[model samples]
Target: MPVSSPQIINMGCRLNLAEGESIRALLAGRDTIVINSCAVTNEAVKQTRQAIRRARREKPDAELVVTGCAAQIDPASFAAMPEVNRVIGNAEKLKSEAWEAYDAVLVQDIMAVRETAPHLAASFSTHARAFVEVQNGCDHRCTFCAIPYGRGNSRSVPAGAVIDRVAALAANHGEVVLTGVDLTSYGPDLPGSPSLGQLVERILHHVPQLRRLRLSSLDGVEIDDRLFALLTQEPRLQPHVHLSLQAGDDMVLKRMKRRHGRAESVALVERLRAARPEIAIGADLIAGFPTEDEAMFANTRALIDDCDIVHAHIFPYSPRAGTPAARMPQVEPAIVKARAARLREAAAARRSRWLQSLIGSAQQVLVERPGDRGHAGNFAEVRVPPSETGEIVTVTIKAVQEGKLIA
Candidate 1:
């Protein structure tokens, strides 16, 4: 019989991606196969099931364990699956003792938990850059969200712990990204209540050797002055911002319980660009939410231009059960899909223009793969001459082909 090393199938956000790396390190040298599932949407749950089945088929003799948000919210459903041998919750997945036990389910009350462990600092992963999770869970109760239930209330890792992790990872990885369920909501739960800005400033000041620092999706409202200043002025930080702007219409935003209005979001981006002309803008927009009329959708569509969103994440509104928005009147499925497509089309056009503008300009590309492929500081993929992997090099943009820059 061939010995099987643990195989981790990860799905979902950057935070989950980072956690998967930690899990992979934890379960090494074992004949177990793990599915690190996501539960952000109904579609995400469906994909988790698909991943589990596929994992089992590929490794029939290995013990199949399921963990992450999907398994945390409904462990019994995953436990009922014939292919699954064990199901662990989000909290238990990190604990060494949880892996030692052979219980059918090791899920605990996530809501009752208060703090998050700095798991990434201890793990070694083979990737172009490292992702360090500074926070986990959410406090906000958005009407269309089930993440809070799955992840529990917002909790932050201490700043000292985070700095230590980054300091260690920065020594090896060329770049490091800060990720969380609610990244901007960091610091409120910790002692002395140091803001995310404070943390970033401290990390930069303490770890001067860190080449590049990137941030995952951000809530536009939470970009305070300290954070905003660093975003505009800091050379070490990447020049890309992905906002969690779900909807562009004020009424739709009100219904979704979002904190920032459309104008506020537009203004924030405007200020960012005014300070730094080269920064790229990315946003997440949902189409055809409950009670959204055509005019409301038009507001959202027009926003793609207003914000100059070069990278867009368009999700056709799918109602998740037990959410407030799910209980309201939903738009037709066809209409939802159509609106989403239009958003993507608009974003692509904006991105094309933005990329074309970069022609003849110099960009620092972080080499990722074996050949000439790498991502720029603004997160644009570029092709350069064959360079050593994990090295950052300056390249002049030559042309755009198939949505990538060639140099």
Candidate 2:
């Protein structure tokens, strides 16, 4: 099948979608479909292959290109597939020359990459809010993570570039989310090593028109003093914070090579809530980690209530190849699935309670689509009467249905 333009299938974090926007611009008018893959979990890898197969079935004659974490980690695997014509590395995919050539597999040593240049996208296709990648790669080697191999050491985009991108997108998008592999670790590689808080302060100070600013998932240990100050004082910065809290048990956290302990995680949440009572906390929790006993799992369950985490992403541990966690004693698949379900259940209950609390409160929602369902600054999903897409409006919450606030 002949295609008019490159079709990009982005998988994984907001960062990938942000990168996809840049890739879309570079491959404009080209007869190809690029699969920007994620290799965070075994299931993610499976989905990447499934997507490639589906793409091939739909567009049999179109040149198929694969890139991103999954392709970067295992380029040969993607290249070996009959459906994929070429496999580009994560670094290569960003370079204009790599996409321009668009002929053979172009995987490179991602670990050697020392700096990350900002890829500015005019707007986002998936989200009403624009995602500007402020940082790339991870310096900390978590036991279960394979992302460091895919995205090199921690490197930050210059604050000036990020501000410019946010300023550009602000014209079209009301909200801009600062996305990265490790957002809190941003700016350590740059000159004078400015902190993430400093970057955010610069953006808000420079771009007054940008209505809202949000940060993607952050590490509990890395919340700088300036960022904490902003969280309490700045209304423009969204009140929703998603933490990378892998496990709630101290032992499990240690095994995962996390910087913060279970107590530290709880304390951080407490501090954030104290600073801004309206702030909605979200977290990523891993269930059934290797060597995690029932007691350890219980600690994780208790953490949900202790931290008041309304929005939680519970992942049943899927051991990845070459990761330290994979080599450890594995948890039974059934047990893993069960624990994950319980965590989800707890999270649902918390979310329901949170929605119920907002029933009578007035909220400013940025309309994501036509039907009036948009997220508030606190990241609560509010459904209102028919409204224009991308318009921010204040509505009084009236009722709750299926965990969504009705306005």
> What lDDT tens digits, residue by residue, belong to model 2 across residues 262-295?
8998989999999899999999999999999999
The TM-scores, one per candidate, come to 0.98, 0.97
lDDT value, residue 20 of candidate 2: 93
Clashing pairs in 2: none
Candidate 2 C-alpha error for residue 260, in Å:
0.7
Q: Considering summed lDDT, which 10 consecutive residues are worst modelled in model 2? A: 117-126
Cα lDDT of model 1 by residue, 200-295, tens digit: 999999999999999999998899999999999999999999999999899999999999899998899999999998889999999989999989
| Angstrom error at residue 84, model 1 | 0.9
CA shift at 180, candidate 1, in angstroms? 0.5
Off by over 4 Å in 1: 1-3, 121-124
Clashes of each: 0, 0
* Predicted structure with the largest lDDT when compared to the true one: 2
State model 1's lDDT: 0.90
User: RMSD of candidate 2 to the true fold?
Assistant: 1.5
